[model samples]
Target: MQEQKGKYEDLKHDELGIKVRSDDNPYLSADLQQKILQPRRLSSYFIVLIESGSITYHLDSQDFTLTDGHLLFAMPNQIFTPPAKTGDLKYFKLLFDENTLALLPQQFPFLVNPSNAQTLVLDNPAKERVIKVFEILNQLLISDKYETDTEIILAYLNSLLSEFNSAYFKNKGPVNILNTNLSKFTEFKLVVETSLTEQPSINAIAEKLALSTNSLYRIVKEYAGTSPKDYFINRLMAEAQRRLRYSNTSVKELAYELGFNDPDYFSRLFKKSTGKSASDFLPRQDLSGK
Candidate 1:
């Protein structure tokens, strides 16, 4: 089955690179809801907080069932397939670009998703707090009064993310912003994301981060639950899945594009990582020329 090539969607209907919507919002028309049901690549950060009811969201090739108190987040360039029918689900959806994130006072480490956990379960107290923040954001974005102040929005956004960050790491123990090990792990993730196709060596990454290979391995395993080499391979496979799902890139081209010298080897590795051949993993559809 050939899937339709998914288009990359940017933040629309908002000037500040941010938009918030809730069940009560009148602007969420049937047409808009239908459009979201299509599988598309997102150009901005996407988040959904389920206040009530349940919906299964498809991100890349994974299905995440989000119900009450569950928050699902996806970063830029990810293939997202919203539920075909929300069916009375009360949810707060947020879309913000990298520019909007830049305006924040502090960096949000959880946004990088070091643990590779896309959904976070919030306790009752945290859930109530998050819902209030989301309500404020929705109101501010839709206010008919004089222009809504951008600073106020950022303040609330920062608060919302703080709640998320705390809840994200709550089980793992508090993350010390000053922890050098945590910083190194975050840097490792950034390097991998930026130079994924380059496939840099673990030793090279450790040297760049001013850490010994042993120390780097410990940090990555502790945070990501994978060895450095395995983490890099997983990242590569994920990118391959994204390209394969959203474009018509052939297996050979994908292999070379992802820095694999042998397309055959790439195919085997893909199968090993995902338990399915690249062709069988997802339908090959190329709607985007790029």
Candidate 2:
């Protein structure tokens, strides 16, 4: 059977859309219970707000525990799994495309600000505001009062996100260590993101930082908990994945564009790093070797 694509369903009631579901939207989740939700690919971002109970999230070989009032943001196109089942869990999840978020930044600049690392906790006041926003959206969705007109919805979304952004900033306490380390990490990610096509080396990054390679690696490891090479490779693989999934560039072309002299070697490296071949990662081509 062909599955539903880009449809949001209220898990508790199939006929009823989640209180505030958008038309053919990209953002939302079906409640999972008892059993573990295995690792799988998703095409949209997930903003998970845990209302009650607890859930464990496993991503990028890291484990995070989310309990009541906690929130998490998961980027699109990544593999995620809900680790070992505990008890009943209730969550309000929003799944939106990246473009939807992009559209938000201009109106609510804080949404796009990288420095806002805090997440919203479900306090009475905060919860009330969020629920109110959802309620308004529900009315809009059901009434079709703003049919095909996203301006009102978008305005409400921005207001909700602004509140969320504020809460996030407040909950995160002053961290001297993170403040310094984050600066380095951001610079490193920026350099790698901007220079990946050139395939900049560790030495090159160190030079840009005006530090010796050894010193730079030590600092990065202290903050990022990963070696420079590993970090850069992760960045590179991310780019490769994006291109593979979203573009028509052949493997050879991708390799060349990524500054690999030998496309075959790039292919092998990519497979080794991700445990999936280039063709397999693309949504269009189903290698499905999970």
Candidate 3:
């Protein structure tokens, strides 16, 4: 049984903390895992590339069955536990910081705001190539090849992601209602992401985009199957979860930051959207600068 001295903590700097430990290591608490008690929270951003075999993962009330050539991503503070006794699952898990994506080519706009939800699943051929890149990254991680090493790894990862995104997310397949509406829908998505901070209205966004609100609504309904207000609320929900999970800010402070005038209204809206009280998400301990 492995015994750790202190609680798991995020890295001190804005750098990824790298540590290689076996599943049996007490820090990972293999015994607790066997007993179905997993209190450990991930302290860094990482990707686990499944080389062979399969594993079941439970995340946010969903069960994901990951097989060979599949990739799993873990974001900071997310709780995880090993699957019940899978035979020697071997994979290359790369742990890095936000800087890793920042170092990627800026032309890939999707990488600009990398979200934890953006998990990439690669097929065999694609997975092999990414693993080779990781081989180079593994060398860089171990050897004192400090200069240009990060750049090299970043480029390799970008290449892998580019191909994976094209295959899995990008439209190259079936042509139908979705294909016809992809461009406009994508533009709307971009507008939502860019303007959520400003809290613009549907009519305002439609005006800015040079389209009438009714026309935009029709297109959004065709593709997204929701009204503009509902869509905006969905976007706001995502931002709220991100803040609640990552930041140590209070509910009132977060409400103000999100441009909500009434904290109580914000709390009610948040609970309606997430089915959990804002206080349940906010850390109990007071945060600095609050």
User: By lDDT, who's the top model here?
Assistant: 1
For model 3, the run of ten residues with the poorest summed lDDT: 1-10
Query: What is the number of residue pairs that collide in model 1?
Result: 0
Q: Which pairs, if any, clash in model 3?
A: 2-26
Instruction: Tell me the tens digit of each residue's lDDT in model 1 across 148-218.
Output: 66677778988998899888888876768448888789889888877899999999999999999999999
Q: Write the per-residue lDDT of candidate 2 for residues 1-290, one digit (tens) a residue.
A: 01222422222221221234322232345444322254556556556666668887765345677887777665445555645435676655555554455444332322322342324466777877776776675565556433434555555666766666666556446644225455565566557755878988899998997778887787668655788999788768877875675467899999998889999999999998899998666556322312
State every prediction's TM-score relative to the real structure. Answer: 0.85, 0.51, 0.57
Where is model 2 more than 4 Å wrong at Cα? 1-38, 82-88, 105-122, 138-148, 171-231, 234-290
All models: lDDT? 0.83, 0.60, 0.60
Q: Which residue ranges in model 1 land beyond 4 Å of their true spot? A: 1-14, 26-31, 174-178, 279-290
**Per-residue CA lDDT of candidate 3, range 1-290, in tens?**
01222322432222434432223322355565455433235555556666777777654334667777776666554545445547877566656544444445533323222222435567677777877776665655555534433444455666755665454454424533224355555567668866776789899988877778987888777656787778888778767766676567888998888878899999999999889888987764322211
lDDT at residue 205 of model 1 (Cα atoms): 96
> Which number leads on TM-score?
1
Candidate that beats the other on TM-score, 1 or 2, i.e. the better one: 1
Angstrom error of the Cα, residue 186, model 1: value is 1.7
